[model samples]
Target: MGLVTIAGMAESGDIPMREPLAYFLTWTTYGTWLPGDQRGWVEKPGRFREPNRNMEVANREQMTEPEFVLTSPQRALVELTIRDHCKFRQWSMHAVNCRTNHVHVVVTATGYSPDDVMKQFKSWCTRRLKEHASKPEAPARGPTKNPANSLPLTLRQKFWTRGGSKRIIFDQEGMENAITYTLDGQ
Candidate 1:
């Protein structure tokens, strides 16, 4: 598979364009970054909003569970799984970095939509994490404390946010910038 076509509006009689070189993906853990964060937030593509303390407070108050942060081991697991999965899928993995609260990756998956690629990465990472976390040799981490209530978080609690950023890398420069940012800047 090669470059895909970005179809133009059919009713408007638009044509197709070449696909981008790769994708720069970023995702945060659940509850760590709220919608109206002081660091700024995105409502959609090209729709960024100024930081709103009120929005952030409201989002925090409505949380069903406490914010998740990755342990060093967990972060290593995530990063490794990303590379392995990309290799298994035959996707070119340009770069990947995992932080305590988020992850960044640049990859070129020839035939997959960015959303599908992000979803697959998130799904496999979660599965591998859970599998690694569930062993008799290691004591279970016990249960996570929910911020909204007294209930302990079950194993089924969500590990990632609902959606993540998937920016198309249009050229080598963009891909290089993303890779540098992921590997060094953040």
Candidate 2:
């Protein structure tokens, strides 16, 4: 009906696959809530009350590198990329903040799912990051005899995790709260 405000949070590799904090999911008619969760969380559908040690170990084992932390320049690049994408798409971005480990954005785009918006932002930001990383100090005069000496064609490092938190804002109060959190809560 009116402008819909969405809060999207994306984490870096710092957070394990399974966390102690409670996470929620909503279905068509109902939602799942898990309490006092341990290793059997995947079997359940909703909120996990406590930490799962086994899951945490498995997640740690899967780590390819140390926790991915964004530097100040990288964070600034991310913010710029997001703002450019929003402007090109004609979406109203109320606030956006990029931290060392995560990013929070408050935006409104009519007829677009929050998940889709988040994905778009993540995709563009990743491209920008890769471009920055692969840039050469000086332009290449010709193709390199040894391909190994050339810049990498693909990005080996990851900037964002698979999925992120998406919340819908239904009222003015919700929009205000989301903006406040994005701007000040960090």
Which prediction has the highest lDDT against the true structure? 1
What Cα-based lDDT does every candidate model obtain?
0.75, 0.55
Q: Per-residue lDDT for 1-186 in model 2, tens only?
A: 222223222222123232212111111100111212253432322233356666556665665533445556767988999889989998888888887667888777776766678878888877887777666751322222324224232334455665555556545666677777778775
Per-residue lDDT value at 173 in model 1: 70
Query: Which residue runs of candidate 1 sit more than 4 Å off their true CA positions?
Result: 1-16, 143-156
What lDDT does candidate 1 reach at residue 183? 92
**Which residue pairs in candidate 2 collide?**
34-47
Residue 116 of model 1, lDDT score: 90
Model 1: weakest 10-residue lDDT segment is: 7-16
lDDT of 1 by residue, 42-120 (tens): 7765467999999999999998767777777778989999999999999999999999889999899988878899999
**lDDT of predicted model 1:** 0.75
